[model samples]
Target: MPRFAANLSMLYNEHGFLDRFAAAARDGFKAVEFLFPYAFAPAELAARLQDNGLRQVLFNAPPGDWDGGERGIACIPGREAEFRDGFLRALEYAQALDCPRIHVMAGLAPVGRRREELKATYMENLGWAARQAAKAGRSVLLEPINTRDMPGFFLNFQEEAHRIVEDIGAKNLLVQMDLYHCQIMEGDLAARIRKYLPTGRVGHFQIAGVPGRFEPDVGEVNYAYLFGVIDEAAAQCGWDGWIGCEYKPRRGAVPYGTGEGLGWLRSPVLPGV
Candidate 1:
């Protein structure tokens, strides 16, 4: 069976971190992924995972000024020190939580900056972060967000992300192809997955509806077909990874509707698995 991980941030917004972990476990999720867990100590988070029999699939490095519209700054010039500090802190948490992957937020490029200079800065900082993560036996991930939601954001398309990973030349650096953003930015989802699977650079996956970023069934993307494509690719390449459900609930989480919401995703990814 294709393993599914619940994105705690999107689900159970009513609960705190620990409560969300418990809720996910109750809902039959064997693994979980959080967007950012910097607010709590890693040791404490690890204990919660152990008690609940959950595995940490992925989490992101802290995006400085997340509330102030500074989503990330790793690729911006003159902010190298801040980026390094942010990554180091995330690495510490990853080690404690035994997380295998950490997503690196490229943030937005500075205004009036040439694309060449911005790309160079991004490569340099990623090299540094990749080395740091390697020492801990973990990989660094680069995610491509949609330009519609995040204007001026660097690394908004799959082709550009692939080129950046190739140029970095670090074994530990990989691409996180978020299907929702990819569908919004680039419509050919399965083709892009097949194109990047050969490189083994695609480290993680996330999904939601395109128009609303809500449950997969309500959107234009056919997840059943998408999962079939992914399963075929994984079999061809002998790859096993978690596919995360990172969608927002259509309504508040209630006992009556929660089952229907989750049941929509309960369909088997691979038949007879």
Candidate 2:
């Protein structure tokens, strides 16, 4: 079994964001990850993790204007400065929380732009972020979001993402493989996991149901089997990082609370380590 992390941004929605830290720890989660930490003070989030005894595994670098439909700013060509500034801000938070990874969203590529230029800008931004993270003793992750979810999402295919990771050529920069999006954009989950295992390039991992983005147990992806695959991948890669439970809880008559849908993840990663 893999070590699991509660994605406070997704799981534990029954409580406020700050309170989710405690809720996760109460439910036997040893670690936590989230989408953004910009809304609260880094010191406050750090305090919550300390109080709850949870490790901050991962979070995304700032995406530009999330409310205005911009998924990220890194690949947006002219937003290089903004992207760097956002990365620095996120790094500050990561440092405070003792987080090890930051997901850099590639942003939605506008239809009329030059694809080459877009890729260049994204690579430049990620290279810079990777260098900074390396200096901070952290890693940078780039996730390939499915086009179905965001329409114009810049990074969509596994091959493309792999190519970008190689092209960037930074040891601290790797793929944040989200099983839900990978199943949507590409279907060879096991093969891909094994292929990347040799390089140990997968920096972080997330899971959700394929068609509905809900609990993994309810998905087209056989999470039970896939969980085994994940373990193999991690073993081969020598990875002991968090497997983030990034999904919606299966709704019941009452709202989903902490641990309501965790029967699928019964295996303990260790005997309390």
Candidate 3:
């Protein structure tokens, strides 16, 4: 079975941060990922993970103005110094949490900016970030968020993410293929996985039902079949990684809830497995 990671950031908004971590542990998840850990001291977060026996599978480099719609800045020109400082801050947190991977969010390029210039800046920052991560024995990932969900984002498609990875040519840099974005940008999910798996660019994955961006069964993505495809690809590529549950709960967390929706977690390994 593919290892599973809980994205605590999405799991329990009603609960306090530490309480959310406790819930994830209680649910039997051994690994977890978060969007940003800058809110708390790195040592405090690390202590919580250690107490709960959870491995920090993934977390993102700090994105400036996280609440003001500044998704990230690695690709923004003239902000290279700010981007580097944010990345280093994340590296320190990663070390404290013993995280093996840190994702570098590719923020939206400025309006009226030339694509060539944005692409060049993206590569330059990624190369520098990758080197820093490598020094810490960690891998840096570049994620492609869908423009439909996040308009004006610099990198929105797998093809562009692939090209960027190729251009950087850093062994430590890779792409994070979020299934939610993939379903919106590209329909042939399995084929895309196969094409990118060989390049070793798929460093992480996030799953959600398309259309609704809710739990797997709430939309038309057919995750049962999708998981099967992922399993096959992992077997073929020898990928031993965690699949993050990064989606919103249908009716919020109901400790006493009952339905097929919640039961999907127990759904057998996708058909072909």
Candidate 4:
């Protein structure tokens, strides 16, 4: 089975941001990832990781003016300079946390910008970011968020994400395939993984229950079998990365002995050592 990491941003929201590290560690997660880390000091975050014996596996580049409704700035036509700055800031945090993967959010397309032009800008920014990350020995990841959840998001389809990676021709750039988003957009989860995994183009993977983004145990997707597929495909291709559990644990989604919605990590269904 593939190694799994918890997405602290969505998983441990019951606790404060800093407190989530300890919470994750207490719940048996050895690695974690989050949407963004610009709010806290990298040194402090690193200290928490060290104290909890958890590895910071991944985090996103700063989303532009998040409160002002910006998901990312990479796809905006005139935000090239802002994109570069945001990437540098994220790189600083990643280095401090010993994180090797950074997912670049393709922000919403500007209201009247030509689609072709915006795509060009997106390609340019991604290529530039890839080269910079390569120099630092890190990989840049791109994810295809479903349009239903994040309307106007520039990168919305798995095919488009793969195309962008090919167009940029950057060896350090790869796709961050989020399983929840894939189920929301398309249904052939196992086939997609088998197709992408063999090419060594998938950098990382994420999971959440489908239909409501709840516990994977009761979702439309058969995570247990799917985990087997992911493991088999990655083993065949020699891919090394964590499958992050990014889901919301509602109050009564499933039975829990420890008062946490971790059905996916339980024995019989979860991967074994």
* TM-scores of all candidate predictions against the true structure: 0.95, 0.95, 0.95, 0.94
Candidate 1 has its poorest 10 consecutive residues by lDDT at 251-260
lDDT per residue as tens, model 1, 17-110: 6788888888899999988998887888999899999999999898889988897888898889999999999988988998999998998888
Residue runs of model 1 more than 4 Å from their true location after superposition: 254-260, 269-273
Model 3 TM-score, 2 decimals: 0.95
Count of clashes, each model: 0, 0, 0, 0
Weakest lDDT window of 10 consecutive positions for candidate 4: 251-260
lDDT of 2 by residue, 1-273 (tens): 888899988987777788888888887899999999999999999999999999999999999999999999889888989999999999899899999999999999988999999999999999999999999999999999988988989899877888889988999988888889999999888888778756778887789988998888876888777767778767766887778999988762245564777877764232211
- The local distance difference test score of model 2 is 0.86
**How does candidate 3 score on lDDT?**
0.83
RMSD per candidate (Å) reads 2.0, 3.0, 1.9, 2.6
| Whole-model lDDT per candidate | 0.85, 0.86, 0.83, 0.86
Write model 4 residue lDDT over 1-273, tens digit each, in one string.
678888878876767789888988888889999999888899999999999999988999988898999999888887889899989998999899999999999988888889899888889999999999988889999999988888988887898899889878898899999999998888798899888888877999998888888877876888888888887887888887899988777763233322366745856364431
Backbone clashes in model 2 = 0
Per-residue lDDT of model 3, residues 84-186, tens digit only: 9999998999899999999998897789889889888889999999999999999999988888889988888889888888888888898898999988987
